[model samples]
Target: MNHDNLLAPYAARSAASRGRKHEEPYKDSRPVFERDRDRIIHCAAFRRLEYKTQVFVNHEGDYYRTRLTHSLEVAQIGRGIARRLHLNEDLVEALALAHDLGHTPFGHTGEVVLNRLMADHGGFEHNRQSLRIVELLEERYPGFDGLNLAWETREGIIKHSSQYDHPGHPEDDDFEPHQRPTLEAQIIDLADEIAYNNHDIDDGLKAGYITLDELAALEIWQDMSALVSRKYPHLRGERQAYQTISHLIGHLIDDLVQTTTENLKAYHIDNLEAVRSHPDYLVRLSGETARKNKQLKAFLYRQLYRHYKVERMRIKAERFVTLLFTSYKENPTLLPRKLQQRFDEHGKERVICDYIAGMTDRSALDEYKRLYEPYERV
Candidate 1:
């Protein structure tokens, strides 16, 4: 109940200060929670997220999860988990909302290309890029550099235990040791998985890329159906799909709540921050659940991600991105003056490419078309 601890979860300092975003206004009209949320919502990165890919490309159908929609879903799911667990709601919302702010266009395809192109200039990692976006990229208040977000928010974005965990501590020279992510951060990662897993299947079905029969035929889907039916026997057919996935989401939330509650209970009574810091402290899913999640991930990769049609599209996207980077470097005049300034300061071709790669699909395409086809607008 300490006020400092209450605020501690959302505090973020700049490269200048070892603290959090201070929303000092003429008058204190909004809570720090509301202010932080609004700041993230209004930032250029947040807006750009709308045009970034979640799984599908921008040229794909509109119903797929763009980065913006995915963030919104993750935020909603995270907030739900936070409310049930009595954790800090604002911190969870902020974590979920800003988690993917630094993602490159064309989903992982663009990330792969950029990482190859910029391996020397500290490489292009989205988590690190996200940290940069909030800490330095966003342009707003004059006195501040970046958003000056809460340390917890930044930690959640960069250290949330996905494959994307960036280097954090000094033990590894190539990368930082990952920060010990909080329970709220853990929930956001699970929420992201849950949100995307179910929705991507839905989108695939809608796009005619995957048939409902194909989905049901998978052993994982069959088990998922069985689990849903065992849990809620009343649902069947279309109701099964809707109700089953809903049940899965609820089940995951329940697991997270129970597991996090146990950890919090231990944390409340113990002097062993060291023990609590272990990754096992936050992992909630059972062996069965873990297996199921893996199966689903594998199924998606084999069926949706590696489909020849989708792979061809992604290959083309990689070529387009490469072309843009090559052209931009050859003729730096095509870049904005601000970008030129960055180029002069960093003096690295890959760093410049990193900046461009972090753009949304539409922005990247626009930049490409602007330079290559000056007369025609994309």
Candidate 2:
């Protein structure tokens, strides 16, 4: 039942100083996990979030939900859920904050295009890319390439997907599926859903892409506005919208926490440590709530995600990625020597594709323009 064992590795640094040396600063301060949260907050990738999309392109407006705002919202919601469930607030906040550090520009468009380009080279998954960003891309330390984050944080980053349901041993090829996430990671998944579900609506409305009436007409949405009013009677307009969502998220978190705690008790599961570490572990929902969630998911799919305008943009992104990937592979001279070295080692088009997947949206666009529309740039 002790919590220390679950958290000790994160508290200790991976490397120990050999020097006769420097004393640790600040006699007693926040734990290393807390420090990790702060580190992610200040990283360049975190800052670029402002320019990245979250359901809509950043160019759409100054007020829409960019990646930074979404991350903040997720962190806030995750922390709220964690505190209510008696989980570690810092761990949840850290995981929430770092969850999307590896997202490419232009949202999922960039992700899909990159994945297709790199499909042969182990393919590119955003979750894996996030891991690569923290572990290998960020060059802060001398001895190691990545931030050398704690095992718990790294595991959460890699395996936070809801599909995790495998054994929890190291030797497994897919350690993520087998490994159970800490309670923090569980909060993050729910928090991410809470954030995007509501925020995307906000963005769509602002962009003239959808309207309140249209949202209200959906069968699942009926009376929800009135429910929102009852839950947040004092707020108005956007504030009301935000509070209404916060209320729904709160209800879900309460239900989840209570159900999970009761389930553990009923089963006489004495693994308090395990239960506490994985507050967000997957659990079957009531058919009613499950159906409601699916309905909302469907509404999003039909109305927001599959609109013709979005499809056209996504198609353009696909073409841009494909064209550039093809050009770079045929004439490796166009790419930086560093990337070309990887191409040489792998000696496959897929290896070259992996190189392209790592580029930022702006970087990809620049490469595309450089190759396709040389005079247009002028």
Candidate 3:
């Protein structure tokens, strides 16, 4: 079914997409953005997300959210917001799923080390790496290097920003860096935040890094917990925490949708052009919600992210990433023959960066053992 009739005037319709970098004849009934979402889901990089870090390392536990689960949650939340706003759900889902395609192992720690190592080699950022993965890395298409996704989808992947992601790259000039992306793209940014913020609380609780008593100090958590308690007085322990988080997510999503809708009308944004020409982002949470969200993030930064145990893991990951990059740079032959062959085309540092960036946490650890541990098998 054509989704055009259901979309708002400002929503990005697949028909009006800037189209793919390498055009191919339409071979299916799926919409352009739907096809982009499918291609992203099936790609090798998407599969690797299962082993990539989110807040916790992949092997830490079976319950914590990995990059793959985070991406899925982001997509689910994005689609919900898109549906409520009459935006293109397919495009939003595509953007949400593809947003983290470039993240390295060990969460941001791996990325930090790689950027420091490649300080003179254009540096490494997950957002830019995400764009690179879709535009150049994946080799499934016989006709193109990357997935050959829609221009809007590509723009969303590169422009995706959150507390963790800062998307500014010299190579993204072609995506109209000055203009705002579609509302669908913008939704993924906040959806990502909403997913991670709430889910991180869950993971942190599960990991014993945080406690309900500690979380109750935050106004957002206090309010949500009170509401959940009133609704389910007998609820306690993990179930109570889960209910509180569920209520918190719903509150956030409602506030975001209401605030963004008001912003659209206040700014006289009735069409895609107005969305693009608008000086500031149209998608946002209300002032109060934004402040509460900030408080929660600050709490997490201090309590969970900067916890002693997490810091220990970060330090070890930094050493692993740094040593891997240094060893590979010092010995070009250490890279697989296929990766080494690309060195002449993409430069030694960048090829090594790509190889390291594509690694899963488990793989990186295994590779470290192989390289550094004498008894470990090659």
Tell me, by lDDT, which candidate is best.
3
The predicted structure with the larger lDDT, 1 or 3, is: 3
- After TM-score superposition, what is the CA distance of residue 369 in candidate 2 from its true location, in Å? 2.3
lDDT of each prediction vs. the true structure?
0.70, 0.65, 0.93
Q: Lowest-lDDT window of 10 residues in candidate 1?
A: 8-17
Residue 349 accuracy (lDDT) in model 3: 99
**Candidate 2 or 3, higher TM-score?**
3
Q: Give each prediction's root-mean-square deviation over alpha carbons.
A: 4.3, 5.5, 0.9
> Candidate 1, which segments miss by more than 4 Å at Cα?
1-18, 21-26, 29-34, 164-179, 217-220, 223-240, 262-276, 279-281, 348-351, 374-378
Candidate 1, residue 206: the lDDT equals: 65
| lDDT per residue as tens, model 1, 162-222 | 6444545332322224335556667777888878887777777666677668777666577
**What digit string (tens of lDDT, one per residue) describes model 2 on residues 209-239?**
7777777766445545677778667767767
Runs in model 3 deviating more than 4 A are: none
Q: Order of all candidates by TM-score, from best down to worst?
A: 3, 1, 2
Clashes of 1: 16
